[model samples]
Target chain A: MPKESDDLSTLGELGESAVLGRIFPRLPAASAQLLGPGDDAAVVAAADGRFVVTTDLMVHGPDFRLAWSLPHDLGWKAAASNLSDVAAMGAVPTALVVAIAAPADSPISLLEGIADGFRDACGALAPGCGIVGGDLSVSDTLTIAVTAFGDLAGRPPVLRSGARPGDVVAVSGALGEAAAGLRVLFAEALDANGAPDAVLASLVRDRTTAQLTPSPPIADGPLAASAGATSMVDLSDGLAIDASRVARASGVRIDFDRGALGADPDLALGGGEDHSLLATFPPGARLPGGFRPIGTVVAPADDEGNVSVILLDGKPYTVSGWDPYTGWKDSGVAGGSAG
Target chain B: MPKESDDLSTLGELGESAVLGRIFPRLPAASAQLLGPGDDAAVVAAADGRFVVTTDLMVHGPDFRLAWSLPHDLGWKAAASNLSDVAAMGAVPTALVVAIAAPADSPISLLEGIADGFRDACGALAPGCGIVGGDLSVSDTLTIAVTAFGDLAGRPPVLRSGARPGDVVAVSGALGEAAAGLRVLFAEALDANGAPDAVLASLVRDRTTAQLTPSPPIADGPLAASAGATSMVDLSDGLAIDASRVARASGVRIDFDRGALGADPDLALGGGEDHSLLATFPPGARLPGGFRPIGTVVAPADDEGNVSVILLDGKPYTVSGWDPYTGWKDSGVAGGSAG
Candidate 1:
């Protein structure tokens, strides 16, 4: 929660080894780690005989703005994004490895904040997770790439292509919060160096900042899988885009009821980066406790038919949402997308 | 092998999705991938229930120079660096996840070459290894961060603290070649476009390029471990620096023979990025086939003694090698170091 300060020691002044010296001690001790950070690599005991792995690259400006978010939040968001993917696979996160590239003139406090974010996310969301190893190098822009490894605990992984006709589409947590928060954060960026109204500031604190640094529904993934969920995905992209991805993969149409998703149709249907679990389960299967049904899976429409892979209240719903390519063009920075 | 050309399409023109489309099909199908790329994450079978993980961050300017290297070589070097670390742990690399940050205006062919490098590396070094997943973003500079996962096959991981007094030190492959190569490449950087003499070009091609794109002895790690090697590390930092690390960790001193290291004492003892495996074996132990003895581990120095961790020709050697911090202050660029 610490804000940026003007006077701080740059990474150049301290050096890579010394910066590492600052980062090493703050990491949590992971029981699954047989050998933690240091040495050439780290060893993690993967008792389930399988490892779920994912990585994300976040760059400054387009993917994030240092002026808008704290380094700790960046770290937390990085962890949350990757960990949610692991959780989406019905796995328990066990270890994380970070490779950070930053300018030598970058502050060591920025890195410490990133470390704090990693510790915070792992501590609050996945206590079993540990930051096992990392590499740091000098870059012109700040970039952090995180690879998270998870254990499946003997259960088969839940994939995106398992949805079938008659399967129910459900979500384990809130859907549009991240998208709303991002819009709020960007709006505040316009008032840079000034104060926002109380209402806007409160919304940023309660909604936007939370998404900028997310806490995904990691536990619901395994719970849903164990409850006989067929296919699953975390909503990093808008619901429409990601859901269509699942629909295309499974070759099924997912019909959504407008009333079921409640108000804020755009957020629920087109928003992205919520990190909420969306799964398809066989009809009448004992649904997981936390998941709420939002739609139903149906067979792909006939070639001659005009039915879409996604529908809103039984009608083809074609709506636009945040796209990395198109979205970044207007931001005045390179419109590159982040994971 | 292609040089930068004006006709090449840039990444911004192609967009992220299109770039990914081109990169995906080039990857060889890996059998160990229970679930391959294109999902939330990749599922890699770790039958032994243990994973040896290592990550490295490579920046364009300091860690590498685009002016000197081809894009394919950069990709190859990134994979070789991380895979070598897995091999250093006495494990077989199974999967890799890369997070690449580049300027949007960067040519798509550069990325294609990088993908080819990753592919070529896995094909040549670790037959079954596959790039399971990755994330791409735009940055002011091009950066590639690779994280590789490996299988230990139920063996105790080789650590750096196991070497004891009286142990013989050995290396699995060539040493000092990389440092010499760097010198050659750096020499070439001075000329810009003027082609070097035949001799320098050949040296740059055979020696420098070889270092830029290394082929570490991956299988030799397990062989050494099985042959009772006590301590091991990849000679990424010159022989002296890495050897000193092992010496301090094992509470012993390493004595090197200038004669055994081949020509160029400076390159052999003080060069960095060789990536060859340097290990210690107990006295009278049957050394693995590929390894050759270079030194011996001796008792730690007494408090009144002035023995250094590394010795040359029976005398304490204190000549300096690359120290990232002190090394880069004058580079004008970030002047950062790599591990």
Candidate 2:
């Protein structure tokens, strides 16, 4: 465990070279990375004549709050957001490169904490995964830009537009926990008192910890693909929006049985930032391990002529989560206000 | 031309999806990209068993300025910076992914201009190299995070630690132009007038244009490797500092002859952001195309025992450029001011 000692040492005080030296050794070595950091660029093992690539940016104010999230949590969240996209593509996560810009006076401990989180998350979440290379710069607001690369291993990528009518929509992990956690965190933050009482904190479920340290089922992506999943997406945004995306792409309607989600059905529909995989499998197809059926894809209804892309319990789902553009500046972070 | 008629259509006014729609069509398509943007992740072709990967972040205020640099220039410069590293690794540039976050009030035209610049740069400098996928978010500052991937063909990667005693040191492209350009840009920015006279602008050579839009000799890295080049590095910093890094890695010294270089020898040695390739080849080895001898690698000196990794005119060279640790705020951009 990195000592949570709040040292005042700043990255500027420790030169760029020295700061790199401090974090490089902490990174785990991966067999998939042919050449690691310190080179002009890193060399990662590829497969199937093609590779899957994706990138995401996490800014300090909009994506996260430094007050509630530790440097370690921020690092884990950044990796989780990007890695989940790779998993959503039905590929096995292989390598990641991060470019971070931070205020000059920021603590060196922030970087050290982030590095620890990066190593630990990869080790626990996707065992052979590792960060290959990265760049560090100086800026007023903290920003982390991560690009994750994955190997398809001879499988065709499961795209959002592949779902057909009668396909069963399933999920590889629990949903709405992140949004719940965000709500709780924000409520406590607004209280002006420190974190809530220990009793209340203990009541928060472990799965809800996704808001801080998401552990998406990355391996399940390839499993789902091999099992013949027709389409897929990462539930980074709320279910209503993400499912609507697939509905629009595939020209269908996603009907979700909210009551079947157990309690707090709105969490499954309106909550966001869970980073779980939402996929559709053909009827009678072998279901992948770690996946549970949540909904179904059907032909659009023509009764009203203007059909809704997503529905809840057979009716149009009116609520939505996290629309960055429509939301005001003072609104909540990336996932927006939770259900 | 991207219709420079900026109507000031803010990103907020256009909405997120609309902004993406505007830029997506403007991006050039590439054969190397098996699955392009609009997907959860992009699939890039990498014939070799391994691929080279790297990332960089360009932040506004410190890395760039809205007052001087247009959005198109920012996009081109971001692409150039990361792609140059790919070339420095002796690999053919293949694909790029960019994640940009900006203030809500920023104009949609900025993104369009950036996309145009990205397409033009890849088309001109490296055909088949184009952005494959990306993410966007809202933030107070404008930031562009670029991650580039490349194929190494069948050649081995040339590392900085491979230089041996008596190796012939050479440069694949011009040096010092970027630093000179930065100096000129800063001087012009400080002028009471927006820009200087046409004569003064012409006096700023084409090489200085590199500071804003660097065009490094990326193809030279692999050529040098195939030609039996022993060691190599990218001169994103000054030649002297970059040479020092090579010498430190190889445990040797590099001697630069001032007389061999034309007038303004300091530009060749002390200027930074050139993005040129500095490499050492075996003595009497056939030099590759686009390379010219600049210095020689030699044994570590033991007479006085005071070591300098890089030497000029057979004497220890002392001048340096862009030491982030030593500089204060209000210095040049591009990792300029830090500790």
Candidate 3:
């Protein structure tokens, strides 16, 4: 932490305007934005008479640890997570409104880096989606809450409840990568006192970056929708759990082939934070380029009296999904609580 | 705080689904919603092909104190603050996406009350606006981040930059009320340890509720826009400060009449957080029913070399606006830091 006397300016020292002045320039301008920041509110072009909206929060403790993830990685993951939601709705993300509350003593560079990350992530993952407005606040906890908007482009929104009995369940992007990366970070990137070691975390950059800065297959969502997809969901939770959601919502059962899953089937089944797109497409339809068939949607067997919504190779598979409340622990590995 | 075994279940004990199941039922259905919660994203109708969007944050420390504010008040204020932004854009608020991150120990009833507050606030303030989507996270600090979206309704967005030299600056909603209420809270609602006392706060309900659950003239925004108002801004800051923003944005000077401002002229000018709409209309144009003329937009005296954008009875007034970063202190009077 750089002192106020040094070159690095803390948020407390610079105030909101100065800090925003540094960050506003770094953010990418959204093409869909009619009126951008600096006003009471920003106006974004919905274009098709409707807009897809979703909000997500990343708190300091449960979401990510500053030790394991840098400001850039946090921003990237935050944007990636929200953009994936819009994509899952089969909409092109147009703009995002980000509200970040950080400790007053935090360096202004933290916000600047986060802004740059937002700019780059939008450039790479969801091209043309940019931040239109945001709010800043002072808090003991560093919290990033992002609300994302998207344009449907005249396509009907792909919903989780649209899957049918004959639908083929497919996935886009890496399933177990983020979870595997988190496990590696927990196992390798801890200091002597059990705190996360950023330096050591960076040493396993390949693994850690996946957990810190996931690139969800954003374009695949609209493609899946365009290719006569029935239901779509962002796989923020593991394959089994998210698939179960689609199954439950659609009144169907999802049967996954073990062979379709990668080498670490258990990790693919139970681990989460992958942010992939899980969609149910019509059988025999060309699976979008980025998507691969992983499972099949089957009619629920009412006579069998089995309550399971997920099956692995014709057997009942029960696995829990990510619930922030139940999933969080006071002090844990990987992204531990800052407090 | 309720124990785990009590009738009131903590968030950690009930898990995310159960908590969400409780909150989802309490929220009002938005008329503009095509797809509501329990999905990847919500779809809202932007009838005119564009949506006015904004986001605002209320962190526990700098924004409010749980000791002084009930969960319902917190929810209402959060929604009110964000809705005002959309209203200031001269658009009708249609939906809100609220993300709340609270401690794991927080009771499910806290979220339930917040939901009820959001329900009631949207019902009373912005009739058709309702919660569309939201996210929850575990955090030490209680944070409420709200993003509001509005429909243009085929009208041009009233912008801060649109105030011209001859525009009659007016305000809709009470000025200095919230700030005065905050002063009352700081003056009376404190215990021996300098912490807020809810019991004491309740005694001054009239004063404190203005600071807690402010009902900004949400309807007056679109009304002003329809009435041919040239410019508009939400008075989240003081009249002098927010007017200065309009002045700066429009490249004009704003001169306020001291007599027109209620009895407490200085308080009305310098105090903040009224959430009122400060708008400018064409000279001699009939002011909206709720709007009262307070000032006038004048040509900037470039030759005089004075850069101050705001004036009170022909004299320069440069009162500062709210800045969470610079304004916050570790421990203060009204809504002090919980840490």
lDDT of 3: 0.85
TM-score of chain A of 1: 0.90
Clashing pairs for predicted structure model 1, backbone only: A181-A208, A236-A273
- What's the lDDT for candidate 1? 0.79
Candidate 1's displacement at residue B219, Å, is: 1.7
Residue ranges of candidate 3 with Cα displaced over 4 Å: A1-7, A303-306, A330-339, B1-7, B304-306, B330-339
Which residue window of length 10 is worst by lDDT in model 3 chain A? A330-339
- The lDDT per prediction is 0.79, 0.79, 0.85
lDDT of 3 by residue, A175-225 (tens): 788888888887899899888898998899876666889999999988998
Cα-based lDDT at residue A1, candidate 2: 53
All candidates in order of DockQ, best leading:
3, 1, 2
Q: Which residue pairs show backbone clashes in model 2?
A: none
* lDDT digits (tens) for residues B75-97 of candidate 3: 88988888899999889999998
Model 2 spans with C-alpha error above 4 angstroms: A4-6, A191-208, A302-306, A328-339, B191-208, B303-306, B324-339
Fraction of the native A-B contacts that model 3 recovers: 0.97
Q: What DockQ number belongs to candidate 3?
A: 0.85
lDDT tens readout by residue for model 1, A259-312: 777687656887777788889999998778578889999888888365468887
Compared with the true structure, what per-residue lDDT tens digits does model 2 show for residues A212-252? 78888888888999999999999888777888889888888
Query: Chain A vs. true chain A, TM-score per candidate?
Result: 0.90, 0.91, 0.94
Using DockQ, give the best candidate's number.
3
- The number of the candidate with the highest lDDT is 3
Model 3, C-alpha of B27: deviation from truth (Å)? 0.3
